[model samples]
Target chain A: MTHAFYVALSYAASGIVVAVLVGWTLLDGRAQQRALKELEAAGIRRRSAARDQAEKKA
Target chain B: MSEPIPAIKKFSDLANPTIFLGLTARIVPFLAVATALMFAFGLYLAFTTEGDYQQGETVRIMYVHVPAAWLSMMCYSIMAASALGTLVWRHPLADVSAKAAAPLGAGFTFLALVTGSLWGKPMWGTWWEWDARLTSVFVLFLMYLGLMALTRALDDPAKSARVAAVLILIGFVNIPIIKFSVEWWNTLHQPASVMRMDGSAIDGEFLRPLLVMAGAFTLLFFTLHFLAIRNEIWRRRVSAQRRLAARMANRES
Candidate 1:
């Protein structure tokens, strides 16, 4: 190719950084959702949520 | 008969984490697709466009470098606004927005620096320069990192957000300096070309692709930001639930 090595490196670096950012965010979201699900399975509900349900019933 | 009004009626309704997360889940996917399409088109244009007479194919680096640089600043500006939200109105999502933005700002700054160095090596015959523009941006990267560390180092969300908001506001002074660095001092970096007051100095051939790519990058930034914010909200919910469970267990014991 007519392009220099630096040009290639720049693109590759950008790609890698962007990919990592997207991947990390996706994984973090999954982990947080999983944690919430586990807590829910353990019957650990947020106080605010419990209060809201009680208020609705009342 | 009047229809039943929804709970979330105005901008303030988004302050509710559940509402914010619900809306973001819908919006981010659209943004993600649009960003991808724009990037694809922009890359095509970037590759097909003629090289600069002076800089040759190396000018393609500008496609990536300039957008990254512009975004590096834009991301900080967003965080500064979020800081205001945190300190002023005390909006619930304010600190969430700021906290989510810090790492992304660092990432954009890192891209700007590395890509600028790559361009400089071929054109300026140097890999790095300590000129005003470069130095200011480097300082910005550090500021972002420092803010991130401060947030994590402090366990209390309320206190940490306050501290980070103050730090973000203080750090905002550097944005103007970075913007005008090439103008205010003798620097290897070029001054404003596209965003000049007297119209863009760049020719139309290069400008079009640059603009598309800029839009794409901006959309990508927002998409990631929304996703990060959604995750942050979920994380907070999990921790809060855990705390409640702990309290309940202590009462039972």
Candidate 2:
């Protein structure tokens, strides 16, 4: 392969790796957020939030 | 009359997941924007700037290769510190950060190895080399993969975190080996240019773009890291809630 091809491949590989990392991180964040929101809607609260609610009631 | 909001006093307040999640939510968007802008300007400098008379157009690969290599070791170092936090302090976010960093560190190491190989083929006349620097980095890469696998192998996330933290600290010995391999031994890989005892060997023309690319890559790491940590935190929350739900169902039954 030509030098240019090698250079291009390097950049392309780096780009693809970076894109995948960013996509996975963002999508995973969104999915986790959705799952937590679903749980909250089901009347399940995070321990801290549950504590705050208990304090408010008392 | 209403009382004022309480001020956060302890440094451990920063370790609170809710506080961390809130802070990351506020900080990540700006970091993402900065990364985008840096990549744009850095690429412009990379392509438009004059090529190395020695390496010619092939020198362009260094912009990405060096930064990825830098981050590979940097991520490991960060993981090592986080590992200490996990064991010594038992800070909650410490394990979370260490867990989140593994895949990203692996990604950067993979990039570094791939780009280094590609660059080597043209310059060194071979794609594969068993030189000290190359071999040590490959070891570091394997260590990263091992840590990731260990983190996922167990059913209990807490158990996995402790196991992986110990592994990360053990694996950190490779990082310094990777750094000094070129100087400590005769290797095909070039010695440090940007970082050195005397000073950087690179010319200003190349250094400018290289610094920009490095900054861009660092920002990208942080942006992805914070996002991943947030996801891990959310995952834990869901798991906790599920266990709670299961307990409630058991009691009702």
Candidate 3:
């Protein structure tokens, strides 16, 4: 491969890796958020949510 | 009687997973915006910088390669510190942070290895080398994968966290080896330029963009780490709810 091709490949590889990392985290975070919301809607309270409510009432 | 804990230590309460998630939720968006801006400015500078006398256009690869290599080691150090918090301090967010970070660390390490090899093929005329630097970095990548797998292997969350924390601490020893390998041995890999004990050898033209890119990458790591930890915290909540339901069902039966 040409020197330019090697350089392009290196940059491209880094770009793809970073894109995949960011994409996966965002998608996973959205899915978990959805699940947490559903559970809360069904009356299950996460410990943090419980604490926040208690502090508010106090 | 023991002296009362200092006020600064009181701030450690932020390590509570719930508080951490709330704080990170507020911070991630701002961090993401800053990282994106930095990347744009850094790339503009990188492309405009005058080409190296020796490496020509190929020198452009350094902007990405150096940051990935730097982050690979940095992510591991973050994990090592988080491991200490998990094992010694029992900080709720510590295990979550370490677990969330392992995948990102592996991705960075993989980028470092692939880009290093790509750059190496052009400069060193070979793609693979058993040199100490390369080998140590590869081992670090394996350690990342191993920790990820070990954390998932056990059904018990508590057991898994402790095991993974121990593994991360053990793997910390290899970091300095990776950092010093180029200098300690005759290797095809270049030694420190920006991080040299003496002043950095890199020219100002190149160093400015490099530092900007490094800052962008660091911010990107934090943004992703925070999101991943938030997901992990939600996942634990779901698991806890399921266990609670099961216990209630058994009691009713």
Candidate 4:
């Protein structure tokens, strides 16, 4: 029936939007986590180098 | 770090991004599952239903159009609450909540307009009208855009939060106006069917799936909202760290 088509269309639109938004959020979240990990790694290296230099001078 | 011992914490402790992010992460999955299940059931109900005697198959558009309109209003209300929380409690997560909600709200509003137009063309024999309800919803869309623009335009996050809070609060006044526009003015839009004082004008066959779809959309919004806010907080944290690194590099140079 014609009613069936409209119903299908509505659900399809809702599904598409929800999928896109969820996908974008997951991808962005993963990128941020990766960036945070890299920053923390670099910070640890810098701190260790600073400590080594201080001990050598002493 | 160990959890703070005090049951009641200072403003800064409550506003901590890590605490907010952890809580949101735990809740998001449940909401997502609920949304998916609800949508599936709603779709099944919608597709299996018979058309109205008068409207024929076009009555099916009501399932989507009505839910999208409900969500557009719901998202704005949530955004207003976040705006209030940000201003009153100075909650860091609240600003992120409002910012994340704006685009989603706009998307819902856009969906409402498009779906309404599609439904209207079949029912009213025209694609567009300058009716009060339509105009008010258009204004709401504009308000959503304005809030998004204001949030992004400011260089300072703190200032952006404050200004956006004000804008959201002001824009909320339009919501009630939109809801009442049909009652207050002559319009091509139909009067309230499901929300009437006596009873719904719509029969159970059409109403059931519409209600289910509305619930599904609401859950979907909340799930996405949580993820969006979490990502925003992480983004801010990463940006802050980058700035700190740049400052350190300058000092060494």
Candidate 5:
């Protein structure tokens, strides 16, 4: 094989690894946010948020 | 009257996950765009530059390899700082930062190894070697793995953070070893070229692409770190909210 192949392989491998990292972070973040949104929709709220709301009302 | 709102006045206030998440929301998009632009420019430079006098087309590998290797170590250093935050200030987000960095660090280290191997095969006529530089880097990859395993093994997040922090700091010793390994011992891997006390040994042509690539990769790392840290914060919030819901249900019953 030509030396170009080696260079291309290196770039390709790095690109794949980076894509996977980006994909995993985005997917995981989406899932976590979805779960949090679902819980909040169900009337489960953080104490801090509740307090902030009360303070704003007062 | 209700109390006045407290504005974010200092860096320490970022330790608050809610504020950090807000910051992440604001900053990550810019980082992502800058990283993408830099990568585009850097790739253009990498491909356009004339091949090295001796190495020919294979010289292109250095653009990616050097940056990956630099980030592998730089990521660990960032983790070390986060470890300190976990130990000294007990910053809530410190372990989250450190934990998020582990997989990314491992990924860069893995890239460095594989890319270096790719470069080596054409230049050195071998795919593997057992020299100082390579071995120390291999050890660094393992360290990242070990820290990640610690993060997963302990179910208690706080305890896991402390444990991982301690291990991260302990493993910090190997970083300098990896740096000086080539200079200190005989190795197939070349010693520092672009980074040196005297000055960079690289020519102007190669240096341009390499620096741009390094800057691009560094930005990308931070971009990913922020994304990962945001995810971890959300993960914690989800668990906390779930527990709160469970307690509320029990009280209702």
Candidate 6:
């Protein structure tokens, strides 16, 4: 029950919590960003196809 | 063709999701690096330092415990401000930031409590107490939980944001109480060391690391907050696109 032990434990615990949170946020952001990119690309492709069809008719 | 000034101005506005995301993405790296560097330096200093004349090694707990407590309060304050902005201006980003910050603030509050208890066990000879500071912090934790629950309970984003914002504003009353608990009432928790009528009770050797760790935690919170908001925005965008696709499919059918 020395002071050093308590101090060390507190620092370690805080560090671990922060690290895990950061890691989780990064991973979640990457996944969501990728999904959004895919959706945006798909929307653009659909628009281009509709434009091509209209031009062909003209 | 050259873009018009008005168009560029509009594009730079916070109302634009793409612009917000782009700005947040660019800042995230610097915040992350600063957080990491500060934490490393703080930990090194905290470990290398000697025990206090009175408190011995347990004094080291002050470095981590105090900074976490500071962050817990700081995060709650930010949440309250964002909540206010959401309610008044109906800022989409403000709501998202407030919602994303709740769990993180709660996590910091939890750390403050747990580490406080651990530090207490060694010094105060008990793990639990009903002192004013401790009780107020416990109440803060409950408020964080309540705000989080309110955020999730409503299905509509606008409704959720409004309700949660109100709850956060009301809960903010506890923050000042938690801060002044040590002075306003007799509490088992010690009085303020950093903020005092005279000066800081701590010496320079310990104060440096504590300040560094506090800075680090602040940076860390900001970095995580930016990333979380980014994820939330993306999630909403994808959902909106899916809804639009479903509607178009139904029309074609």
Residue range B113-225, candidate 5, lDDT tens digits: 99999999999999989999999999999999999998988877999998899989999999999999999999988889988999999999999999999999999999999
> Over the full model, what C-alpha lDDT does candidate 2 score relative to the true structure?
0.90
Model 3, range B1-253, lDDT digits (tens) per residue?
0112222245776875655666776788899999999999998998889889998877878888899989999999999999999899988888888999999999999998998898888888999899999999999999999998988788677888888999899999999999999989999999898988799999998899999999999999999998898888878878897677677779989
lDDT of 1: 0.90
> By TM-score, is 3 or 5 better?
5
Q: Rank the candidates by DockQ, best first.
A: 5, 2, 1, 3, 6, 4
Which pairs of residues have clashing backbones in candidate 3? Answer: none
Question: Considering summed lDDT, which 10 consecutive residues are worst modelled in model 1 chain B?
Answer: B1-10
**For residue B141, what is the lDDT in candidate 3?**
95
Question: Model 5 chain B, poorest ten-residue lDDT window?
Answer: B1-10
As for candidate 3, its interface RMSD to one decimal place is: 1.2
Per DockQ, the best of the predicted structures is 5
Off-target runs (Cα >4 Å) in candidate 5 are B1-6
Model 6 error, position A53 (Å): 17
Best-to-worst order by lDDT is: 5, 1, 2, 3, 4, 6
User: For every candidate, what share of the true interface contacts is present?
Assistant: 0.80, 0.89, 0.83, 0.48, 0.95, 0.67
**CA lDDT scores, all candidates in order:** 0.90, 0.90, 0.86, 0.82, 0.93, 0.81
Per-residue accuracy of model 6 over B151-181 as CA lDDT, tens digit each: 8787667888888888889989999999999
Q: Count the backbone clashes (under 3 Å) in each candidate.
A: 0, 0, 0, 1, 0, 2
The CAPRI-style docking tier of model 4 reads: acceptable
Measured as a fraction from 0 to 1, the native contacts recovered by model 4 come to 0.48
Docking quality of model 5: it rates as high
**Candidate 3: where is the Cα deviation over 4 Å?**
A47-58, B1-10
* Residue B1 shift from truth in candidate 6, angstroms: 23
Point out the higher-scoring one by lDDT: 5 or 6: 5
Candidate 2 wrongly placed segments (more than 4 Å): B1-10
| Per-residue lDDT value at A48 in model 3 | 52
Q: For model 6, what is the error of residue A56's alpha carbon versus the real structure, in angstroms, after optimal superposition?
A: 20
Candidate that beats the other on TM-score, 2 or 6, i.e. the better one: 2
